[model samples]
Target: MAGNMFGRLFGKPKEEVSPLSTLEKLNETLEMLEKKENLMQKKIAQEMEKAKEFTRAKNKRAAIQCLKRKKLYEQQVEQLANNQLRIQDQMIMLESAKVTTETVDALRSGAQAMRAQLKTTKIDDVDKTMDEINESTEDMKAIQEALANPVGGMAEFDDDDLLTELEELEGQELDEQLLAPSTAAPATHLPSVPTARVPAQAGKAQPVRTEEDDELAALQAEMAL
Candidate 1:
């Protein structure tokens, strides 16, 4: 199979030509062409002076012939200038292409190196990563389980059982309240005792009383009192 002609067209220049180098070459070429054009203009002027001298010497035809030759030389110089411009354009394009090719090759090599490194790495490394992931999962599971089922001393009394007991105590208290007396009952009264009434005797103009009578009456009165 034959390679592409464009790819094989030219060998690399002595310098690894970059865009800047291409631009520098273009500028140098332009300056060189400009200098040549200037020199050609000076030569044209000298030829015109010579042609004027020939005319002053009454040789008009020869002077005209010299001017025509000078015009041809100027045309050739203009053609050279156009060729220099074309070469500069080609160099600029080539430099851009070279930069693009180098960038692509660097990227390709980097990708190839990464793939080679990946191939060289141990397959067991993935297993180790999986094991670490499983360990973390197990730790999380353990933490979740601990949160779901609390351990040790206070585990005996859950909130539901405590709430049920509290409700039962409240029910008992309500029953006790329901059984209490509505209004307080009055205390029982004791039976009353009957007393005899003494009758008063009629007076027979009551006898005059002696001291002994008075004393006997006093003693009876004292006994009755």
Candidate 2:
């Protein structure tokens, strides 16, 4: 029966059934609710107008009853509006979730590609590193051997020997100074001595000449002639 063609196919209007696109479906639902609300509001307004006429005719009870019904109708419309807003909020959340999923997938794919690239890239410095290590090892060995067998120990020992020789030379110099003449000033204080001057004789001193002086005078008188 589901596959069979209906008997009255000509008179029946073809109900256009549109496949709802995502946002279009939500909008269409919201629009349908709005239309229903508007229709309900018009009905409420008509009731209110009828109640106003009853109030003008002094029917207070009927007016109050109409106002209460209007309030209930408004409350229902408000509830429907809230539901529409909630649906919109859900739609927004769903779209955000979809975007987040796509972003995460892209990031994951990129990460995997990076990992693959890292695996493929070759680091060719192993031999170079080993060569450097060997060279450094050889240098260290040479240094260690040089330290173990130091050249010319005598040259290093000469500093101590030279110091000993200097000490000996200094001791010899001190001995020579002690044995040498002492030309320095005396250590004790002494009193000064006065020297005497001899006085000369006057001319009355008869025969005040020595034999040598008489001899010298005679020789001078002979030479004068």
Candidate 3:
């Protein structure tokens, strides 16, 4: 709908002039008018100079005639300037219209392309594709998890049963350690007092003797007999 409007605004019959060609023609006319205006300005200045010279010579009639021609040239220059302004205004309007039409046409083309893409793609189709991908990903994850699990009948083993077996083995080891006998030698007791002693001097106390001293005294008595 918007494209139609722009086409109607910018389109022209073969007999009608296009905006570009019209702008060119206006530019040429403006240049020509400018040249004519410049020429007229120069002519006006020349007439003023002529009028000054005539006035210096005391020729009032010739000076008056030169002044009248200068006024006419000024009037023509003003008219040319007004014409140039009008042409410039027309060119600006045409260029603005052209720009607006081009902008709308670009927007219309983009809108059409977007609509085509929308038609070719559907929301349901997109959802289904995503769902398939998700399912495939989940299947892959399951396969990976299965592959990562323990192999060779290990997965069938029970954690509780293994712990019970380990506890029994530890118990048996503790029992064996408790039943074992120590291999260390027996310890002997030593008496603090001696079993026999020899008499000392009357002023001194008698010295105590150990069992080894008694054995030695018996051995000496046997040897003397």
Clashes of 2: 0
lDDT (Cα, tens digit) per residue for candidate 3, span 136-200: 99999999999998989998999899999999999999999988987685855333333354557
Which 10 consecutive residues of model 3 have the lowest summed lDDT? 189-198
Q: What is the lDDT of residue 34 in candidate 3?
A: 93
Candidates 1 and 3 compared by lDDT, better number: 3
lDDT of 1 by residue, 97-177 (tens): 878989999999999999999997777998898999999999999999989885687787789988999999999999999
Q: Lowest summed-lDDT stretch of 10 residues in model 2?
A: 189-198
Would you give me the overall lDDT of model 2? Answer: 0.77
lDDT of each: 0.79, 0.77, 0.89
Predicted candidate 2 versus true structure: per-residue lDDT over 1-225, tens digit per residue: 533446355445667643245657777887888887887788789879988998999999999988888888888788888878986886787678768878999999999999998786656566677889999999999999888764686546666888999999999999999999889958652332232444656755444556566566666666666
**In terms of TM-score, which candidate is strongest?**
3
In candidate 1, how many Å is residue 68 off?
2.3
Ranking by lDDT: 3, 1, 2
Q: What would the C-alpha RMSD of candidate 1 be, to one decimal place?
A: 19.5
Looking at model 3, the pairs that clash are 194-209
In Å, residue 198's CA in model 2 sits off its true spot by 99
